[model samples]
Target: MLKTILSISGKPGLYRLLSSGKNTLIVESLQTKKRIPVLPKDRVVSLGDISMFTDGEDIALSEVLTRLHEKQAGVAVSEELLKDSDALRNSFGEVIPNFDRERVYTSDIKKLYTWYNILIEAGITDFADQDEAE
Candidate 1:
């Protein structure tokens, strides 16, 4: 499941973008000039490479997830069968808090595969602005 999620949402701006160890989340704003800090569980517009090179450190999606957890903000994995842009636009939703195996088991496996492939097929791959912390 994790592999599938990464494979599809791997493209920028289509999921709850997370870094490896940061304390902030990079929520894309359509009306602002900066990526803001959101609760870990906050659904986000993850359509680009949200990584940042601050001073010298590289901030990647993995780091964002770490930070989200530290902030104690809830994050939900959206399985919504939406268009690429639509998926990015409404990325913010209820966070799941924790992804226990039992919780995932509740969903139908076939459905999961469908959503995963859809993203992989239609997700974007350009505009990964590295080092956004400039």
Candidate 2:
């Protein structure tokens, strides 16, 4: 699930891993369904590999997303909330109460919401890894 989804730096949206070659990985845009080759120089990060800073320990992105889903009742984050930095902080606080305020910037919150909404639109409500779920 999250393992196959990648975030390529400099790309506008999330991409789904399609295939791999010797020096490039094929990826399909989750938004437009367009296929493109990700070169070796491109910074590609798997969604599963992302984590958020917390007061005690780092929390996996999947866990944060799951908490967000439950908090929002699986609905997309509101545009109004997204626009206000304070509101975004407050909302994320509700999702992850102990999230490190100093480490998690407003931009990170915005990106998290954007990615969550995109995944919801793509009909991917399950954020947990299959092995973890079992």
Best by lDDT: 2
Candidate 1 CA-lDDT value? 0.34
RMSD (Cα, Å) of model 2? 0.9
Model 1 per-residue lDDT tens digits across residues 1-134:
12112222223323333343355544432322234446546543332433433334544543434343333233323445333533432221212223332333323222333433344444322222344433
The residue-by-residue lDDT of candidate 2 on 14-90, one tens digit each, is: 99999999999999999999999999999999999999999999999999999999999999999999999999999
Best by TM-score: 2
Displacement of residue 125 (Cα, Å) in model 2 is 0.7
For model 2, the stretches where C-alpha displacement exceeds 4 angstroms are none
TM-score for each model: 0.22, 0.97
lDDT of each: 0.34, 0.95
Where model 1 places Cα greater than 4 Å from the true spot, the runs are 1-50, 75-134
Displacement of the residue 19 alpha carbon in candidate 2, Å: 0.8
Model 1 lowest lDDT segment of ten: 1-10
Score residue 119 of candidate 1 by CA lDDT.
40
Q: Against the hidden true structure, what lDDT does model 2 obtain?
A: 0.95
Residue 68 of model 2: what lDDT? 98
lDDT for 60 in candidate 2 is 92
